[model samples]
Target: MYAIVEIAGQQFKVAKDQRVFVNRLASEEGQEVSFDNVLLIGDGDNVTLGAPAIDGAQVSAKVLKHLKGDKVIVFKKKRRKGYRVKNGHRQSLTEIVIEGITASGAKKAAPKKETKKADAPKAKKATGKADDLKKIEGAGPKAAEAMVNAGLDTFAKVADAKPEELSKILSEASSRLAHIVTETWPKQAKLAAEGKWDELKELQDRLDGGIEK
Candidate 1:
């Protein structure tokens, strides 16, 4: 059976024989780790979603290997200050294969995951015309695409966005989008500098409610 499980504070849908990389643990290779935090369980014809988590449910996995990820080089410098620092780090990881899922809900054998051929590269989808988004003060074409997906297609919409509202809308965003909004967006930076996004959002919400500004 397939199950949704949490590992190292991250949620993942896992099925039997599927290999997954998770945070480093002290288990030896070929050892077994059974997580009792199954969130959901699914069979061939039935699916069960947990209320936060399922009781008496577990997902067992076998540790295949312990390895380090690719090395990352960190460099820091102060321009014209004659100060520089360099460091390298590799994240420890554990690769585990899902073995079985057990619960009172249902039972189903896991299906083999489809593997993509190495020779066939995935195609990239075009976002939109770059010029359409480049005109915004702080948004580029990629950022505009992200905004559009988040239901903000106009500059006025961005200007009226509340920080918490924006955060909720972009909760599924990649780290790149988070970094762009937190570190790169000029108007957002200005609003953050003035600490006015919350107030702005409140005003926008009131306006939408037909309250006079």
Candidate 2:
């Protein structure tokens, strides 16, 4: 018997005792994981297909190990601009062996329910003060609000964020704030978090609208 299952956003044809490598899962080694998104199951001449995914059908596997794939180099260049960048990346992966495949009659696991304490009343929302992120160069009220909403409410949090992460957050926020440059936000936030206002001022003066001038 064989089954087509979706694992970690990818699909694969798997059979009993077959070993497969997939995107990294949160499960630890030797832990069992089940995939309920089975698309099709076949045995001999009989086959069952799901409209989207089979109900109650599941494919079980045991995580064998977690490892990183080979590195891939990324190179970029702009002609006559004296701009070039090079980077490398490796993808995390998990190896698993198929243990069993159940076409139907498997009971889905029940979700655990939270037990609220009877003595606890509804908690009030926090109205406490947060850092004024707008003080940072290139950050406006909308950008600050977006950062706060994304849990970067403190200068330290903003300082610890990478430029790529900050760009992703701003892009998800709104188009009005999409054009804002973040190359120097982390540096400025780090200075602010350290209470070095004079140094931050000097740095901002050298920067043109948050871009290194």
- Give me the candidate number with maximum lDDT: 2
Global CA lDDT of candidate 1, please? 0.59
| Cα lDDT, all candidates | 0.59, 0.80
How many steric overlaps are in each model, in order? 0, 0
Question: TM-score of the candidate numbered 1?
Answer: 0.45
- Residue 159 deviation, candidate 2, in Å? 13
Q: Compose the digit string of candidate 1's lDDT tens values, residues 62-109.
A: 989867788798899999999999866565667999988888543333
- Score residue 180 of candidate 2 by CA lDDT: 57
Candidate 2 Cα outliers beyond 4 Å, as residue runs? 111-213
Cα lDDT, model 2, residue 158: 91
Show the colliding residue pairs in model 1: none
**Native-to-model Cα distance after best TM-score fit, residue 2 in candidate 2, in Å:** 0.8
lDDT of 2 by residue, 37-97 (tens): 7999999999999998888899999999977788788899999999999866566678999
